[model samples]
Structures are given as structure tokens and as C-alpha cells.
Target: MIKLIGVALIAAGFALRVNTLLVVLAAGLATGFAAGFSLNEIMAMIGKYFTDNRAMTLPIVLMLPVVGLLERYGLKERAEVLIRRSKAATAGRVILLYTAVRQISISLGVSIGGHAGAVRPLVAPMAEAAARGRGGELSAASVVSIRAHAAAGENIGNFFGEDIFIAVGAILLMKGFFEAQGMNVSVWAMALWGIPTAFIAFAAMWWRCQMLDRRIERTAADNAKAGGVQ
Candidate 1:
């Protein structure tokens, strides 16, 4: 029961909204001491784990500063301008194109976009521009809905596409899990199986994009009517 002080520390840290990485490290140190590990032993264990697993998080940490630099240079504004200048651009069309690009790039193991790296600072603004077009701005509800759809498009594209890449984290995880369960599975086979699923996901989302176009237009019309009546 005394060893559970670590759990309380974790809970308190989160409640206080402390930096998550700091909180976790603090709780782990506390738990190690509680478990009767010496300071040297705890440090050794932490060093070992960090060496083994830091690859997973290091790229994201390194990229954050670069992403911030780009955003500060008006990446989002440029994306909006480019899309708005193209008369053919529409919210649904832009999202659909992005879905295809995302899926293809992920399949090749090229992580070209993420919610933070791409969506917030580029995709979302481009999508909003398309929704607004040359017409009056989209209603608040319409803007939110289009952004949600754009985000979903990115997610669906990534989820299904990465499975097609044998070296992707999810497929490696699946392979490891199955191997642990004493089942021999091939990473290539799993990737092959993901092909049909990827196609199905694209088809389904394409249909949904069509529906999204109609929905955005209808929402705009309703907002216009409400304003006129006022």
C-alpha cells in the first residue's frame, strides 16, 4: 500500500496540470524508491529505457521547433490564399484531394501531414477557404462541420494507408502482438490484407465528401434565411 504513493503523485500532478513528461518521470522515480530500488539502480533503469525507446518520440520533439518556424511564416495564410484563388476549389474537393494525397504518402511511409504539422497550419485553413469560396462566409456551424470533416479525412487516410506499409508502427505492433501470442504472422501478408481495406475506406469517404458538399451548401442557405428573416 505504501508503494502506491506513486499513483497518488501521478493523480495530483495531472490535476495540477503539470508538464506531463515531468509528472510521469517524477512518479516513476517515486515508484522506484517505494519499490526499494537504490538511486543508482533507478538511474540505470531510466537510462536503459530511454536509450531503447527514445526513437519513438525524438522525431516529434525535433520537428516541433521547425513546425513553429513555418507557422510563424504564415503557412496557413498562404494555403488559404492559394485555394481561394482557384475557382474550382470547394471544401469537399479540397478535402478529397488531401485524403488521396495523405493515403498515398502514408502508404509510401512518407508522413507528409499530421493534425499539428499540417491540418492546423495548412489543411484546415485551405478547407475553410474552400467552404467560404467567393460566397459570403460559411455559417459558424458550417465552418466547424467542414473542419471536422477535413480532420476525419486526414485520419481515415492515415489509418488505412499506413497499414499498407509493412514497416508502419501499427503493422509492426500487430506483428509483435501476434508473435507474442505464439502465432507466426508475416508483415508482408498483413500489409497485403490492408489493401482492400484501404480502397474501401477511400470509396466510403469519397461518398461522404459528396454528402459534405451538399450539407455545407444547405447550412449556408439556412443561415442566410435566418439572417434575412431577422
Candidate 2:
């Protein structure tokens, strides 16, 4: 069916690395046209859909100014200082703890830890600063690596942990899908089983953070020795 034109547009757009918003809009237009809707009618549909969703998003947009104000006053620096002063908290350790906390929070229905909200202004900078403090001094490569790892930890923790919550959309979807196949299952059962999987993922990422810290230390020492020779 020409209805599938939207799907083709999406696939092509992604394969060509088009801007996501643009691609989605284009796909929507194509689908609307294929379904016998005029361009103006399609525009109206888009307007109505956005109007419904916009109310839900107003709170997030409103909070951004508050977060931006905090960043202007040195939120990242404060986070670094707080972590450094705490003996048991390395930057990596702090991020690991945050990963656990963020994941658990998402499972608890607070999905606030995302790129715009948490990663850019707080977690990444704090992790980088922590890495630099403990590893003597970080090179550009090390800084990027530490930032990447911090992001990876957040993503992994959220993805694997959120399924452990009965109220999460994924668990509800799973329940629907299984029941459709005549297999009755409860969301609570699915969530309870997800706990062990979340723990395993957490431990694996924590181990990686430990290894990265060790490697950073070794690299810093090597750089120091090389500098001494010069």
C-alpha cells in the first residue's frame, strides 16, 4: 500500500542521516497525502497533535530555564568539588552511583535523567573533572573517553533497569503482547524477573568503570614518566 510510503521515507531518511525532526515531518506529510488528505488538512492534523502533546511538555521547557540559571552559576563545578571532597567518591564512582540512582528513579516513574536534563550540564563535566583530578591530568583522548563512558553508563542503566517497574510502558506492552497470544502474565511478574537482569547490568558497567579508572591511572603515570625524561 502507498500507506507504506511513510515507512520508506523514514528508512531512507535515517539511512541518509537526515535531521530527525525533518525526516519525521516529511514522512508524516507523505503518509497523509497517500491517505487522501490535502496538505492543509495534514497541517491541521499536525497542529492538533502537537497542541495535545505541547501541554505535557510545558513543564519540562519551564524547568530548562531554571537549570540553565544553575549552570550559569557553576553547577558542574559544584558537583566536581562535592565529589572530590568525598573520599569514597571518585568521578567514576560518583557516576556509577548516579547510574544506579537514575536507573532506579526511571523504574520508579521519574525519567528525568536525559541528555538535555542531566548529562550535558552535570554528569559529563563532573565525570571529566573527577577523572582529571585522580588521573593527574587527562589528555583530549582521555577526556572524550571519560565523557563517553559516563554517557554509556547512563544509557545502559536506564535501558536495562526501567523494565523492572510494573508501571513502565515496556512492561505493559509485554503484558498486552503475551495476553494476545493467550498467555496470561502479570506486569509485576515481569518486573520482578527484570531485577536480576538490572543488577547484572549494573555490576558489569561498574566493573568497566573500575577498569577504565585503572587504565587512566596507568596512562597518567606513563605520561608523567615521559615528561620527566624530557
The candidate that wins on lDDT is 1
lDDT per residue (tens digit) for residues 1-230 in model 1: 97998899999999999999999999989999999999999999899867655545565577778767877898656755755565657788888888887999899876767787677777778778877873467767777877898899999999989999876667776876686589999989999999998999999989988898888888778778778312
Q: List the residue pairs that clash in candidate 2.
A: none
Give the per-residue lDDT digits (tens) of candidate 2, residues 107-181.
776565677666777788777777777766787777777788888888987898889867665776677668658
Model 2 spans with C-alpha error above 4 angstroms? 1-10, 18-88, 228-230
Provide C-alpha RMSD values for all models, in order.
Answer: 5.3, 5.5
Q: Model 2 — TM-score against the truth?
A: 0.67
Model 2 gets an lDDT of 0.78
